[model samples]
Target: MKLNLTPLFAALLLAGCASVGSVDPAPLPLAPGAYKTTAANDATALTASWWQSFADPVLDELVGRAMAANTSVQAAANRLAQARAVLGSAEASRLPQVGVAAGAGRAADPGARAITRYSAGLDLAYELDLGGRLLHERNASALDVQAREQLLADARLLVQANVARSYLALRALDAEREIVAGTVAAYGETLSLTEKRARAGDVADLDVARVQAELAANEAEALALERRRLELETALAVLLGEAASSFRLVPATWATALPAVPAGLPSELLQRRPDLAAARSQLQAAKARVGVAQAAWWPSLALTAQGGGASSELSNLLRSGASTWGIGLLAALPIFDGGRREAGVQAARAQLDGSAIAFREQFLLALKEVEDQLGALTLLRAQGEANARAVSAASQALRLSDTRYRNGLVSQLELLDARRSELANRRAALQVRSAQYQTTVGLIRALGGGWATGA
Candidate 1:
């Protein structure tokens, strides 16, 4: 039978143009216009280094160290480098491959004189990307590199937030410890007075016992705060990539001034979050892979050319008669593989679907995080105000009880109770303040380092 390849070639060319089955991802349902708690008119965008807003030099230095040396951040950076290398390799594969080879061999037969042969050759081979397979593969690799880059950004952001929170917690603990120490000292003075009054037969021994118990309790509370401070210091050291045992943060006060963050329109959030960007990049990569899989169902064409010279003597290898050269074209069409190509196409489509869904989920998650932090800050601020009033009132009541006790107008037990209430109120106020600082950090992170109006 005489074969006519025109129709076959035409059909294959047209099939190669078919699009992948993967669907393009679209914007998902997220919070609308503006955050409920944040101002809508402020237009400043989030700073790249949001931790600087804390205005603490120690915290700033710690965050910087974490970003530079934290293990998670370092690992992510390495992954980005690897992805870039893969992308380079894929792109290079699209061009022709050329190489040179040289060899020498000696052979002897039982009834023949020994002889030597020498050869040298240059070869070139290239897969003609007539089906767009190589192009799509390279596109996928490029997207992978973008995804890895975003992942690295996410890692850095997490490290910075962790370091900030740890350092702030240590300071909060220190503040609370100071309050306990103050209470302990007050109890000590009261105990001394009760002992003197008892010796003078003006107060009973029970009064002395009560004051001693209060002093012991405050001292115990102080010890617990110290332990917590030590733990936080160790955590911060690890974040800075240093040995926990060898690292220490000097006692410092927590910064109460929280910089107001701009919460931009929800639409802009998709672009600001690194995790969302990473998900979107992965979706693009998966879509490209679908095209690659579809391309595999069609025929592949390759062009190869080689020129070489061979001779018994190395000096004569390049002589005109001893030289040789050839050119050829190769094609491969999937004949049958038990539906393997179909399975691959289905798998690629499935992966594309997964990636698209993942992108949507990531968007929703980011929105939820932002809202949660906003709500926390709002409520915590109100609670903080209430706590401030309680502390003030308790302090005034304690002063009255002390004066009355000094004049023997009230029992020692009543005076001790007043002191305890004052200490508790002070500690509660400190806790609310600490919570505000911590939640503010969370809000910044949830907003993807910061936000800008109209962003």
Candidate 2:
């Protein structure tokens, strides 16, 4: 059987048209010599397990649990598996499809006599990729797999960072709580002494009331800090893929080693982020699709083959006289589709353009993140020192004021002011230290200094 098809210059189509699939999908590459903000030393190299740099056993354990159990990471892994399956299908499209069949039936022959007809056969079909359309499609699918793999890496990195940040912040809250608790005890002692003096007629009741107010305020602040710490712990539990009721991070010493990064990092480090790599993969997949769209302008060719045997008896199905075979090639071209092909090309190109812009935006964001974190770390370091000095001065002033108040050399108001100053400065100093820890982790993540692929 035959049907009329849009005719092509048979020779030209067979020989392959030079301009048939001519579309260059220009890809973006990271700029050479990207501003050198690399790691400081060999020990600081970005590794798959970067959380180890902190040297906190609890943190290391939690991060490990998160990487293995986080829901987002598991979801990404599922996606990667799906992408790989899709890639396998795309690859199969480029290979020969073969099948076998056997059948027996009762039928009437030309003489109108009943007959038992037995048949067995094998068939094969394949597309000849003259325009690389199928090839591009397969390549695009492969890129999708790559992108998904990178996305999996990205999910792990995000979970790791959040765990470290939340844990460190919780520890900071503990430190602050300790400071407040100590101050509360001191205030309690002072209040008791002030009340005794009031009863002895050495100090007025106003002094006792003032001490009471200060003690209550510090106690309130301590409770608020505990509330915040509980919230952080709950968030961490989710990150670790555990039920909040079953998880608890008890208050302990914050001994996580704070690692420092170096100045003027190299350009190669810029491309290490999984998110950035995923973006690049997405762009390449889009580019491959553009090529697929371009290939659509060319004709498609297919090759078919079959071998079979037929006989009146099942035993004779493969007999010498019952054998038959044939082979053929076919071609198809769409003469007109009212600009549908053109529209496809345009859509694909548009997608490619958007991907390019997205890639650029990601690159710019990467740069800004690194810079912001670096600057923050520097400013925080200096701030920590200043807060330390303030705390020291405040502590000394409070000690002197307490002594003077006992001797009646300073008023109750002056002593209370000194205590407030010392508490505020001490809390400020703790906050600065916390910022340094949190910012260091941010710097590691923002700088894309973690999770090397295929590790």
Candidate 3:
């Protein structure tokens, strides 16, 4: 039997001439605009390291360490690498695959004859991509890689925010510890005065006992604050990829200055947030996948070339008379596979729809976070101011109470009460200030800080 390769070549050429299928771009569910909220002028510009606005060098260092060591950031980087490799693999489908082959063998007849044969050939196969299937796949893979890169960026931003928040908590606890220590000292002095008065019959034993109990409570509160600081340090250590027991965070005593928040529109969040950007890219990838799946419905055309030589002697295998070459076409049409192809297309369409929804959801969430942070900042600033004034008034009251007690004009109990109020107010002010600074950091994070605005 003789096989003619001409017809196969003609068919492949004809298939190449066939019109490529069209892929409709998926409709983006979210409008290409900033988010909207009831509050006007709530938008703020984002800085990349918004934490630096607090002017805490220790916090800056901690954030740098976490970015270098955080496991989640590393994981996102690894995922991006995987996506790039996948894209490379998809791209390879567009080029021809060629291979060389060689063989030698001997055969023996059952009766008496023996023969030797030698052969060698070059083989090639290429998908003509008549319907741009490989192109669609490559495009989808590229978009996936982009999406993964954005995901990595998002992870980094999250880690930065977490590290900053933890650092702020640690500083707040330190402030509390200081306040408690001062109160304990004040109580100790009051207890000493009360004890002397009791011995002199100027005051009752109850006054001495009351001062002692207050001192003990202040000491206990100090101890609790210490514990909280330690816990925060441990958390920060873990984020830096260190053993909590082995790592220690030095207490930061510097006053944190709040950074100015950039006023921006809600719609700016969509452009600034890496998570939102990644979500949009993923939606694009999903849309491209729909095209890839749809391409499955069209017939695929492939071209193959195989040439070889056969001879009784290995030396003559490459001779023209001993060599044969042929080209062939392979075509696959989906006849009926229980509707698998159709099902795949439908599934891809569903995935596209899901991605669109996810993108919109993410955008809206980002907007809400920014707006909420803005509102929180406004409230916190007012609270901080009120607390500051309260601290000042409490201090004045404590001083007046002390003078009155020394002059025998007020009871020891009144003096003790004034001291306690002063301590509470001071501690509350410290905490409120810390809260205000942390809220500012949150606003920066929500705004996507420096990186969000092309920093």
Candidate 4:
């Protein structure tokens, strides 16, 4: 009896695969039910178009433009497209490979006479995945495509958040410049009055000098604010993928509505962050690759066939006597190698371990960011309230001091002090409001846009 040992060898190789043990990954950090710095919960779930919640048309337009034009976002999109193409190629690999060929050749016959032959043929090959190698490879590629998709989402989120923050900072500068410009005007008026008093000998030259110094200082501050504002504008231009000189954001009232976004549960963040989703996909892909590498040690089976006709004359090739055909069953088993397959499996498992650890790190960072932004917003609200009160009190004090000084009941120094105090308070209040808007954006980004989990 004839005996075929291919099946027996395949079985033994599969058994060998069971001996390649995988290292168990360390446990992931537990997520709390709620963040330690959790705020009041709101009904707002995360949405992809989270920027619209801010209710600023200019901001909305800028974000849209940046999403379309930013180089980094474009690069991420290209990567996604490439990964999808690779996935298509992977999926197509399981299908039979077919080709057509036609050729004409001249050769010396056995009798030393020159002869010409014409042939046309169709060739086909199909690999049978008896060891699951092709299946695992396809699965790995599919998972990688998923990872690339999530990475694209992550890139968009980053660009949206940055555009919002930069625009907010620019608006804050507009408000600050308004305050400083007003102070400069007031200081200029005070200097005019002080010079008149010095000419009439009603006040000393020291008072005149102090007023002049205050006016110049306020003017200098106003100029500095303008410079900073221009820089921000230029920075924003770059964010929008334009030349700094060509992009100009007109100064306008700070009217971007600050949406109250509450911090959701910690569990929600795991599902909402694209970066985390990407890491998870990558980890799964690594696991799939390990299977592929381990499968390399097993046997592979394939089917091949070729059909053709050949004759001395092209027309004669169609005759039944000139027809030719072939079929083959190919089997391959790795009898011995210098540990290449084993090394591949080991390397694949190492990648799996790395991916798992990376996923854990990503989760930890996501949790920390959400908590950090939540805490900042919570504190910023109270700080804004206190600063507003200070501005109110300082304004009232400044009015009183101005009236008293004009009536000769107080020194000009006290009036200058009151004005300086009021300006400082106004600036502090503006800074606090700016922080509130920027922090809300941060919290929104940390929440992964509107609150729903990443798909």
Candidate 5:
């Protein structure tokens, strides 16, 4: 039996066109603010651009160069541009497309009617978004643009952090080099004094030999420290997008203390971190994609219009009598596609699920980073204090040993040992200070300290 299917198709299309209210995912709950590992009061204020807290002009310059010339930052900017272009294309799809055509021709046929036609007119075509498919696509594209923008922001912040860390490392190496050089000089002097005493028969030859060995060891250490400093400078130069061979970082000896880091609640991280923002945008885009996929199960309607003129004479082509115009609507309904539409809907839902999970992961990682930095900073501070005390005690012991050797109250061996101990303590203290400063910088970066949304 033959059956009319137009009504059935129309009813299915109408049902598919029904609005699907947006699904709102629950906000993830964060831990309370009262969790504290130490008794020290937490600093409450966090800066978005925390690198400036160091007040180092050189560091500021390096960060600027990286932001401008770093290859990674450039790549991120390019991606953002691409995403915006895609968004513009999607928006344009929602508007009617128009075009103009003009042509001239002469034809002669041996048989029938030999006709020459000339036509000029504007043509228009518009897709009716009957089921909001185009709207969903446009919204998804816009969200993608926002996601790319946030990604670029995150990349810039990462580059800034890299430059700052590299600069800190170079400065720390410089400090270590100074410590090694001073120790070498002190060892050289001790060796010279032992030689003079040996010559005057006030000390044994073994005493002079031991002091000479200690001096040589210190010289080797000094050479190693200088080599490390050169390596660190090269690394810093590369981060600033400069040729390592052509670049030289002038060492700035700023012994300023590390700035205090502000520790807010874990919930604050969701608002401050760029990665989290990007993740949320990605989720929104995925959510919109689900609507776009669901809309595919419905029919699409399009309105098209065309007008033109044709005549043997060019003059007659402009006359309304010779003109032809027509307007029509086209509709398409997917009948049987071997379950492609259903598969698409399933894929879109899966993607939305993945995006949601990814957003939660980013949020949790941000929280973990803040906590790790906080604990590191706390331990580094305590270590710095203990190192300072050790340095002072070693300094006094070295001084006493030097006096005793000169008064013949102790051997050259004793003075050499004390000098070595003092040098080691000095180096260790400098290391602790360096670590403390670096950890504090890391904490500030983790807290989203150095960059703002527009900056």
Candidate 6:
């Protein structure tokens, strides 16, 4: 039979009328080229695994463990899987749907003789997608998958950065603990000297009491440092997805070498940051949903076909003479439904607006994070240098004061003051170093694990 092509052609022509209103989404604004603060020798491209730049084998191992086992990372992975499954389902909807049906029935009216019927059939159906509703839905689902993938990346970066920061903090605490222990020991020696001088009538007994009090204070400070260290160790264990009670990290010296990161142009950050990527993906998905909603306002067309055999006897169901078949074209247009379809369109558009705003907000947040970290690192470096000088001078003063006290040229209190000053200076220096490392990790995380351009 010759097909009627005129109606099909007319439907195709009117398909464009069903499209929802759309706005061309523009890219978010970015800051001008170059960051306000970037260190010398730091103009290198960011890498995917930025943590490896630290060159510490132990840290590398810890970060790897966290990436593989951290609960947050695992959760993000699961979400990505879910998004992929949804995308698959949406894509499958775009193709024809086929199903099978089989049935046997027996019925009787009043005392009439019973009759039986048996049937088996294959049913096929497909939406025409003239308005692109299914297409838009599939596209939205695909964008969701991409967004989830980006989220997984962001989660991994956060977990690694957290582990690094915790580890560095523990190391800093270890150094401070050693300083406090030394201070306690030195105070003990001073107390011993004060006691001897008191017995020899060279110093008053009150001097000996003051020395004992200072010794006790240093011991208490040492205990506090140990407590802080334990807390950091426990936190690190959790980040590594291990039982804190069963985990222990032995004290090790902090590495002097830190990876220098170049803050690339703010425009490059749009591609480098996983969070930004995720935001953009969500925006795309929202835009697709608006199209899907707009498509709903138009009539839907579906083609259905069924073929089957029916017979009163099950054995005769497949017989050639018992065959039955039918084909249908269904078109449904909602004249009115209390404005449900219009409401859906409005809601989708509202969501699109919100997503657009969110994308911009994420961009701003990414820029702020990079700037904050860079500024902090620059100041910390200067502070670290000043702290090193203070430590050196304090050490020299402590040595001279010790000699003077032994020669009876300085009071025991003066000797204790010098010793405390030197310890304080050393601990301060260690803290500055720790901050530098922590800030560097923060910067890396902010840059989305050093995502290189075009990655």
Q: What's the lDDT of the predicted structure labeled candidate 5? A: 0.74
Number of clashing residue pairs in every model? 0, 4, 13, 5, 8, 0
> Using Cα atoms with residue i matched to residue i, what is each candidate's TM-score against the true structure?
0.90, 0.88, 0.87, 0.91, 0.87, 0.91
Kindly give the stretch of ten consecutive residues in candidate 4 with the minimal lDDT sum: 1-10
| Cα TM-score of candidate 2 | 0.88
lDDT on C-alpha atoms for all candidate structures: 0.78, 0.81, 0.74, 0.82, 0.74, 0.80
The TM-score ranking, best first, is: 4, 6, 1, 2, 5, 3
Q: Which has the better lDDT: candidate 5, or candidate 6?
A: 6
Model 3 Cα lDDT, one tens digit per residue, 252-350 = 685766565544443333465677667767767777787788888789899999999889987888888999899999999978889898889888878
lDDT tens digits, residues 1-455, model 4? 12232343233223223332453433656554455565655545546688887889999899989988988889999999998898888888899999999999999999999999999989999999887889888988998899899999999999999999999999999999999999998988888989898999999999989988988998899889888989889888877888998999999998898777544543444465788778778877888889899889889899999998999999999789998999999999988899999999889999877876787678678768877987898888789899989999999999999999989999999999999999999999999999988888888788677555542
Please give the TM-score that candidate 3 achieves against the real structure: 0.87
Per-residue lDDT tens digits for candidate 5, residues 206-282, read 88878778878878887887788788788777777789999988766865445665433333433656777787788
Error of 2 at 50 (Å): 2.0
Candidate 5 wrongly placed segments (more than 4 Å): 1-33, 38-48, 105-114, 199-209, 263-266, 450-455
For candidate 3, give the lDDT. 0.74
Q: Name the regions of candidate 6 deviating beyond 4 angstroms.
A: 1-30, 42-46, 109-111, 263-270, 451-455
lDDT score, candidate 3, position 44: 38
